[model samples]
Target: MENLFSHPESEPEPSQQDDDALEPFIITVVVPTNVSHAFQGFTDHPHLWWPLDQESVFGEGSHVEFEENLILETAEDGRTSVWGTIDDWQPPLSFHASWYPASTPLWSTEIRVSFRAVEEGTEVRLVHDGWEGAEDPAASRASYAEGWPRVLERYVRFMGGAVA
Candidate 1:
């Protein structure tokens, strides 16, 4: 899974200001399914499972969909938003994206998800990082500490389990 998170040569190297490792938060949960079911549940059927936190991402009447690994939120009024870009799309193993939640429009936050087969099911790990800027970064990071857990709870319920 480390190989999946590595960047290409063309991408700029991380700087001191772009550091997320020092203050990033992570959430790990076990879903009652195989790698494929867990990965597809997050990537393909997110609209069905993802927490409909209207204040975070999609707006009212907007639905999330994937286009060539790009996450989009389109509304009935024809307003479409770029939710995030899937940086890595290795199915049933891992996926990473530059997430632009509605609350943080200044820049994107990085989200890395990894799936591994476990004795009971698949262990899904989520790392939300790349929080730059000022105090908002810290505040945002703290806020997500609460938010991701709720989101993962939904994932667990949708996956037909209580592990998360």
Candidate 2:
């Protein structure tokens, strides 16, 4: 079967398309580092790149309390959870997480980040799958299609020297 999560020919455009049949959205970002350092920064230093505006589910060392093995994010007003249970934690090479939206049934696809060495830097490939069950799969894909670029751009800049 074709990898639904493979990078599409083009990013989803909200206006021109129906936004109801958009398929997998893949985003790959290259950063200046080897596999080891890239993996380290991705998991250990998430706070540096994770949007500060959003609440965090996992901090320095919070206990996993839920039966479902999820990381909970709470604020004064509301709470949300994005799949945080670690599927694989091998360092400096690959890591996978369940990418499920909080408040939804646990239908998750693996998000695998691979680090490979290149002439200029390490290529970070982020693939978020399991989109078939999303509430609005097309809309979700569209949103992520646009969002990943911005997030990756921030990640690249932050890695380069921009402060959070």
Please report the candidate that would top TM-score against the real structure.
1
Q: Whole-model Cα lDDT per candidate?
A: 0.78, 0.61
**Candidate 2: stretches off by over 4 Å:** 1-22, 54-82, 105-109, 161-164
Residue pairs with backbone atoms closer than 3 Å in model 2 (clashes) = none
> lDDT tens digits, residues 29-136, model 2?
778766677767766565566553532344433322222344344434444455556667566777776665443455554467778888867788887666776676
Candidate 2 clash figure, as a count: 0
Candidate 1 Cα RMSD (Å): 10.8
The reply for model 1, stretches above 4 Å from the true place, is: 1-22, 53-55, 58-60, 103-106, 133-135
Q: Scored by Cα lDDT, where does model 2 land? A: 0.61
For model 1, residues 1-164, the per-residue Cα lDDT tens digits are 56987878697778875465347788899988999988898888877876665333545566777779788877667777877889898887998988885533457788899999999899999998877732367677777887888878888889988741
Best prediction by lDDT? 1
